[model samples]
Target: MFEFSLRQVALCGQQPWEEPGELAEPPSDLAAVIGTNGDQFRDSFTRLCLYLARTYDDAPQTRTDDTVVIGTEYGNTEALTRLQLGALADGKMLSAKHFPNATSSSASAFVNIGIGATGRNLTLNAGLLTPVIAIWQALYALAADRSSTSKVLVGDVYSAEALLDAKREANGLRCRSGLTHATFVKGREFRADFDFTADHEAVVTLGAQIGSDKSIDRNGAFVTADFLDVIQKLDVGEQSVLTCRGPLARRGALTVTRQNFDTVGNGGLGE
Candidate 1:
């Protein structure tokens, strides 16, 4: 089990789409924050990244050493589809602007650029389990490099286009479209433990320990939102956990404890 401090959390729920088969409008101030004339961030995915990145940038305690890990199941689906359709129809590439957003990692790249983070950056596409997996990656990074000052920024975004794609592919699975961000620091405000198991016993055991009152189950596409709610409601010295079951017989569990800093030391894990 790896552990870290969840210092802050930010989230943006599904934005209104005026029409079907079109990307949602970006936040009004997004262009100003990114220093653009509303041209660079045409796609919803990049806009969402910038919006969340601005949260970290605007924070008073923003750190220079930062790692970014973003997860998405259907990344920039509208741009990718447009690219594919353009290629198939005319045998010509789509607009150069759309080319960069076609890849899954482009959103994360934009986030790194938006926040000016120079440390390690990664993107993952693990379907419904993406958020939990991303958190696990962040915890692992912190645990592996104890002396590193880098704080991990982990997040996931699902656009309306992604939801439409899910409907087309998954026989209307009713996926939610939203974005969430959480920052994990070196000090201990929460302790997250990861588990990879084929059976559900681990989740059951951890669930019992955390209890139904304090635990939240990963029942939908965006469990991070629920996890954030629990964190916000938690009092100092309160503990909670989030559990999920992933594909290929995999399970994950994250235990969070709101530490009372008055009594607890700043050292985490091995220290």
Candidate 2:
């Protein structure tokens, strides 16, 4: 069991998703770019971090000790073995060789732009959120054991080539191409709350409901923008149940809520 609270949430991304015909395809060099391809990844990743900074005014600092990072890392080639690729992805931050050049590089910008730094940096990566949470729980417990205070930062980045790569696979599993970064810090101010638990039943029921109705929510919700509005409606004490695939072919659930904040008046918020 693990729990926390979030007083602030910020998000940024390309909007309206220009029509396919409206945009030119990525260059061939960028096709199937891996995280190990330092230059390409850093350029894209830096732009993402910049967008986050503009939206939240909180740029990423080069902290390698006190922060825990969790995310997905798909490989650049189909020949990459699942075990090998997973290992490669998981070990991204450790290999200085994969880091972009210090001169005229995005990674350099990311390192130089941030003002806050900490000492507990750690990186944990996974293909999905469940494992990310599980890893966070374990690592967080270890941090507590050591009597250390740390924050958890989660992020994910995907490219069009990665999505196309998946479509060519036999399983044809779903894929998303985007960048996401979230910050988690410990505090008791502003009266916020969050909860996560395993609930297999809710996962199945929700999947059925979505499938049968052919919609995620009653408002025919689809796309990231549409979903963002749904999230805004969440209020203190109102729980949001989430389901995800766990390790070794298992199912898991997580429940989230805002506690101690009033959402009844003042436009879905409490004081």
Assess every candidate by TM-score. Answer: 0.72, 0.50
Give candidate 1's whole-model lDDT: 0.55
Q: What are the lDDT figures for the candidates, one per model?
A: 0.55, 0.34
| Candidate 2 vs. true structure, TM-score | 0.50
Give candidate 1's TM-score: 0.72
What digit string (tens of lDDT, one per residue) describes model 1 on residues 148-196? Answer: 3333333333445555455554322334355666666676655655665
Worst 10-residue lDDT window for candidate 2 reads 216-225
lDDT, residue 50, model 2: 37
The positional error of residue 129 in candidate 1, measured at the CA in angstroms, is 1.5
Per-residue CA lDDT of model 2 for 45-138, tens digit only, reads 4444334423432434443333433233442221222223555778843345543332223332342334243443333333343323533553
User: Which candidate should be chosen as best, given lDDT against the real structure?
Assistant: 1
